[model samples]
Target: MRIRAATLKLGETFIGIQLAKIVESKNPKYPVGQYVTAHFGWRSHTISDGSPINGQIPALVPNFGGLPLSLALGVLGRPELVRRDRNRCWWSVGSHVGQIAKIKGCKVIGITGSDEKGRVLVEELGFDHFINYKIADVDKALTELAPEGVDCFFDN
Candidate 1:
């Protein structure tokens, strides 16, 4: 559930775990400078010596071939098919999510905290439109941005 680099160990209890970069070899699947999100604990490095299940260090850093490591802690690791539902639409995590949604044939409406952020969401991030929640009415903005209803909403 937690990545080693993001974790802060307070004596015995583990606090946080961010994604960690693995020492890569010439293995075709894993390249150098690539990161791996793992449930390794609250340390800068990961050691699998004390694992109860595997009882050994992993030879490879799981299946992290072509996707971004930041997503390994989340959705890209999930095997379920992306589906459209009432809850999947509306909130925007960032331009990355918006661009991904657009690439998946879904309309993306980003709601951000600033005008500059909104501009980035639309102009740079490839969002169909952006609603600035800071300076405008949220309800009205949502109504205007997504008049056709939300198909997916990611809060990041």
Candidate 2:
């Protein structure tokens, strides 16, 4: 099928995608020249929608607004290339995961590297609790905060 391929443009190490041209008479379901997330490559370009990579796994291009395009290539795109739970947390990934989890009605307990980040996680993102791993004893905090035990612990 005609699809965009991420090719290392000559002399450049980065990749770009090749998007299928939109049939003019009807606007393609995925319009051309309009930015949308695709698990295309480390470089920038478009591709034609292709066969499912894995039947069990759906295509991932979680929407974000005003985010730099490169964030898609490096952070968002990397997960599709690997076998990792999308819910894992890191300094940056935690922020996104927390937001998504909250939307999914999951109570989030953010364990961040610093107290300031912890505060932000709770106040700004609506996390149920925050554990500053650098300052607070994680086990004690977690026990007090989530006495019921953790259903999911995402570590990034």
Candidate 3:
């Protein structure tokens, strides 16, 4: 099999492959030319029988609507599934998570170490509100920002 390394594990000579060509496959799930993302490790090629490792199976890359396939490595893949439950109040929003939450119709309140980053979270990232953990009491900020308490908390 041919692979394009995507993620690396410590001390491993090979890393996860984001783009791969199936030189051969006995499993119907994996066919030649079907691009897949899997933690196969840092190698130009590897062979597998389509077995799951630690319950983690290689997932097929879905259509990206003309978006880059690399986006599957992060934002467009798991994050889309992460935000499926809408109408929740979210806390400590990271940039990508916050944006995805908002797109999924969740109310987002970001927490940052600096006021500048907090401002960016609100102004640039479109978070509904931000708390500078350095300057404000987190407990107090949480109470004020989410009067009914947060429904979700995302730690970057």
Candidate 4:
């Protein structure tokens, strides 16, 4: 059995993602030189046996038609891909659509269930603003956050 070498002390885990290049491979599904994204944490290197954990293995970074790989680490990176590949069933439609909006120089405001989620949506995902629907009135919050009407609204 393979052992995961911890970067930090045992019994603690970092919840994170990485863009990894396959330097060597025996698996036909993931060839060498291909790029993959996974919740491989903060390791400099990792070994994946191509087994499913929570029904997920490493997912290939999509070919963005020559766009830089660094974009894969940002708003274009994790959300929709992981939502689909890992069977995570995340509410990704709005996030991905917001990503597109941000790319095109539009403002984005994500409405989520918790403040922590809203924080990540705004701070990490390039959203201009976010509202926690669980505690705030969405319509009122939207009015407060953006006195002018928003250009678009997305729901799933």
Per lDDT, the best of the predicted structures is: 4
Candidate lDDT scores, in order, read: 0.52, 0.53, 0.63, 0.65
Runs of candidate 4 exceeding 4 Å displacement? 1-90
Determine which window of 10 residues in candidate 4 has minimal summed lDDT: 81-90
Candidate 4: residue pairs that collide: none
TM-score of each model, paired residue for residue = 0.43, 0.46, 0.46, 0.42
Candidate 2: tens digits of C-alpha lDDT, residues 1-156: 012224434555332332222333133544433444433434443334544422322133434586534334333223233222222244666687677678867777777676677778888878888776676777777778878866555444
- Off-target runs (Cα >4 Å) in candidate 3 are 1-93
Estimate the lDDT of model 2.
0.53
Clashing pairs in 3: 14-41, 14-42, 15-41, 15-42
Clashing pairs in 2: 3-48, 4-18, 4-47, 4-48, 15-43, 17-45, 17-46, 18-46, 19-46
Q: What is the per-residue lDDT of model 1 for residues 1-156, given as tens digits with 9 covering 90 to 100?
A: 346434745565453333566564555554566554434554556543323323333333455576534344433123233322222123442454567667867666766667777777777777787666656776776777677754334554
Q: State the lDDT of candidate 3 residue by residue for 19-114, as single tens digits.
A: 566777888998777777677754668777777743668887777788645455542223332332222223332577778778977788776667
Better model by lDDT: candidate 2 vs candidate 3: 3
Which residue pairs collide in model 1, if any? 6-17, 6-18, 7-16, 7-17, 88-152, 88-153, 89-152, 89-153
Can you tell me which runs of candidate 1 are displaced by over 4 Å? 1-93
Prediction 2 TM-score vs. true: 0.46
Candidate 4 per-residue C-alpha lDDT over 1-156 given as tens digits, one digit per residue, 9 for 90 to 100? 013444546766554566789998989999999898777765668788778634568888888797556556643333232111111112665677677778977777777777787777777788888777667877787788778865344444
